[model samples]
Target: MDKRDLVIRPIRAEDIGAVQDFLFTQLQELFAQDGQAAITDDVWGLGKTYLEPDNCNMWAVFTPEGTVVGTAAICAYNGRIELLKGRYHLPTTAEVGRCYIDAKLRRQGIGSKLVEAMTQFCKDHGYRTMYLHTHHFLPGGFNFWQKQGFAITIDQGGSLEIVHMEKIL
Candidate 1:
């Protein structure tokens, strides 16, 4: 089906299983090319937990007929509260991750829509800043994040060079 027949919306509770399946499929495809070291149980667990509305914010892209086609999540983090001090030190910050669109629907604007939706979600959730990390090797990921106004904060070498980017909300 054409991507134009799709709609994007907040993830519903009933959609969790489908979202997870989509996520696993995408991850498997990624690993098939990059190798298994890139996949981790922790990452899988985190994705599952992040779908819970109370724990994290997520958005799902679905076909007009109701099939989920993409998913994104904003995992929050705060750098201010000195754990030793037990006090707040800085504004809330969030890390955007688990952004995956069905391979067939890529380049059809679904990815950008998901990012924009997540950014709005972060803003509504009171996040003062948002950050995400992408590898330099993922075809167009680095450039795409840059186009979206995410500044590169770090670059580490490997088959995949980690590139961190952030924007203040």
Candidate 2:
């Protein structure tokens, strides 16, 4: 649990597989609960996309032995900003998602460390606000974002209810 025992850095090409497996495993569990397929949008495995996109970045938290324990992303999703801008008067927003931490490692501060790194990355990249979309299905989704200073802005229920949250940053 010591800070020095972990490293947080931009994900590399080789990291895509392990990170993808980690994320897909989580998604699979959710899908199984609904008796659905585990497959998700193909973008989850695209490490190069995260690297080459403008104002987009992702990090993987690794143990001293180099096992990836957590991940976070800050991406340029301007299209989603209109929803917040029209309603909340929020400024330019960077979208943050694709964050996951190995369940066994939860409560050890790895998630916070990833978020801190992404926050610095966003600030350095000139983002003064952030937006994230999470559904109630995601474990600890609401509370975690709230603890990170994000407030729930919208939640719409249909076949699925997506929660939208924002932070002034």
Worst 10 residues of 1 by lDDT: 81-90
lDDT of 1 by residue, 33-122 (tens): 756445445345644667654537778898887877887888666453232122222356777877888777877788899889888878
lDDT of each: 0.73, 0.74
TM-score of each candidate structure, all chains considered together? 0.81, 0.82
**What does the lDDT read for residue 95 in candidate 1?**
73
lDDT of 2 by residue, 94-122 (tens): 78877887777766677788888888888
Best by lDDT: 2
Model 1's TM-score against the true structure? 0.81
- Candidate 2 C-alpha error for residue 29, in Å: 2.6
Off by over 4 Å in 1: 38-48, 51-55, 78-91
